[model samples]
Target: MRILLISVNRERMPYPVAPLGLAYIAGALKAGGHDVRAIDLCFSTDIEHDLTRIVEDFPPDAIGISLRNLDNLTYPSSLSYLPELEETVAIVRRRTPVPLVIGGSGFSLAPLPLMRRVDLDFGVVGEGEGSIVELVGRLEQGASAQGIPGVLIKGEDGFIPPLPLASFHAPDRSVLDNERYLKEGGMANLQTKRGCPFDCIYCTYPLLEGKKCRMRGVGEVVQELKVLQAEHGADYIYFVDDIFNYPADYTAALCDEMIAQEAVVKWTSFVNPRFLTTALCALMAKAGCQGLELGIDTGSAKMLRAYGKGFDKEDVARAARYCQEAGLPLAVYLLLGGPGEDDATLQESFALMDRLNPTAIIVMVGIRIYPDTALQKIAVQEGLIARADDLLEPRFYISPLIGSERLIETITEAAMKRQGWIVPGLEINISVPLMEGMRKFGLRGPLWELAGRMRRPRMRPLR
Candidate 1:
């Protein structure tokens, strides 16, 4: 089978993400004895022309498109990708009659809505690699892919659940903007693990990857990192795992393996405060971890409980102190004004944040409700949304008690005073062209950090 995997994600506000999902699917197809090529639209100079040329030159038996994100996930600024995706599909259809299939984090989050919104012919709900291979094979054979796990056929009633995320497929860089994404998108990313065990209310990890944590072998992860460092000249890497510190033993082993391999690639990841410790932080730093991004959620334990966070404010503070001791820059993420938010809770958050004094704080006003998250249930119960509301359109929960106006105002005011604090974020201070210009001058690892460092001189002390 001849396959074409297209990545349609062009949103790079925070940082452009590599199309690892598409790369994996391409690898799986290739491994399955199929000829595959991937086209990434992230750094595309001309998507329409390139896509047209590709379609005309190498027409594939099947085409799989990956959608990493829908809206920007920002509350008020909700920049949607539906129009762009629909246009992408229309362009492909015009060029060729190949069967259309969709998959990715965005597609999986609201598969039904996406399928309806974009009028998709086929989509894979969960894991894409194996499912895509099977789908392509079935398409090649002109047979039904009815019972294949993770395969979602058009007009189908149900889908088979994907197998445990134990198997790993290295990305197919042959069909990627590999070097460009590695450099401009901040850094190369390696998934050391899949799935999350914790039940966070607004998180889409569990919905897309499941609750079962399936970590790859430490040695395997390190080997991949070494290859990225040596072969791709990747100086820095980002672990795109849900919880890098979870299953403490796995994280410890992975860090140890990186140290053992002498992998010179510096890395960063999203760490859950519950599993972080001084020992682990030290190991991470020794293993070449330059910084840590902590998903602190909120500073008030009351709001923490409402957000379904496993760690409390004290635990958060302790984790921050551990990162500090390890000499790691810690960026704390706070999701405020959700189910149980008020002025008191907001005050408590800022008050506790002062105590923690993280290297950086990223604050978000409202929590977006996806189809199957606990936040969805809470939103419906709280009358913020109906149970069957279309979540693909970016509906958010700001807690009627606190109100979004007040929440945004408080966060904006606080963020203005607090250095290294970004309110209503998922953004960057510098422009893309300026960042790219800096990247050419050999700058990397999130431009926002530099912005944070520069702000210290002008930032006023929060009262």
Candidate 2:
């Protein structure tokens, strides 16, 4: 069976991301003895021309489209990718009559809504590596894909629960042009693990990857890093795990393995402050961790509890101190205007950032509410959204107490006073041209450090 996998993600605001998920599915299919070809549309200038050429040349038996994001997630300047997705689907349909399948993090979030919105034969809810192989095999056999787990047929009322994988497939990085991503996107992405155990209210990671953390073997991770460096000329890597520091023992072992194997590749990942320690921080730095991004969500203790972050301000401070002592740059992410946001809580966040002085402070104003999250229930109870709202159009929950206008004003004012503070919500800084110019000059990794070198001038909030 010849399978055509298309990555339909084109969001390149802060930086473009290569479709690691699609590559995993392609790897799994190839390992299962199926011919797989992949196309990344992130840098595609003319989607119709490129897609038409591919379809004409390969003429696939089944086509799988990966949707990474439904919207930009930035408030005020939010852009929906649905139109682009529809355009891609239409182009593919006109080119061939092959089965169209959609599955990715974005489509998995609202599979039913997306299915209704666009014309698709099937949708895979959770991890598609296993399900996609089975789907393609079934289609090759000319059998009905009625009972496959995680496979949703067109016009189906309900879907079976997605099966959990014990381990991940060795992603076929060759399926896409990784060298281009390294040059344009700043860093190549790899995942050391899957799943999240945190109970953050507005998060969808637990829903997407279950609560259990599945760690890849340390040796395999190190080998993949080596391959990325040797075969692809990738110097910097960003681990796309939901939380790379959870299961502290596994993280420590992985870092040690990287050191033992002498992979010598610079990397960064999202780290939870709760499990971070001085020893672990030092080990990570020794293992070539260039930077760390902490999803602190908020700096106020009151808002931390309200947001179900499971960690307090003190934990964040301790983590910051450990990173500082280890000489590892830290980037802090904050999500304000949630359920308990107010002027005082906002002040607390700014004060904490000022005191800790991380390498970068990326702040977002509103919480994008998704279904099956604690946030969705709270939004319904508080009358922010109705029970039946599908939330497919990117509705955000901004605290009525703080108000959107005032929250933007306050954050913009505070960010202007500090260096290394970025507010994508305002669309003030981190332009694409600026990032491209930096990457062309051989800058790699998360360029947030350089992006935050100087304080940005005040600009009108994005309307």
Best by TM-score: 2
**TM-score between model 2 and native:** 0.98
TM-score per candidate: 0.95, 0.98
Per residue, candidate 2 scores C-alpha lDDT tens digits across 49-70 of: 9999998899899999999889
RMSD of each: 2.7, 1.6
The superposed Cα distance between candidate 2 and the true structure at residue 12, in angstroms, equals 1.4
lDDT of 1 by residue, 60-149 (tens): 888889998888778666778888799899999988887899998888887876777676689897888777877888888899888888
Candidate 2, which segments miss by more than 4 Å at Cα?
Answer: 455-463
Q: Give residue 31's error in model 1 in angstroms.
A: 0.4
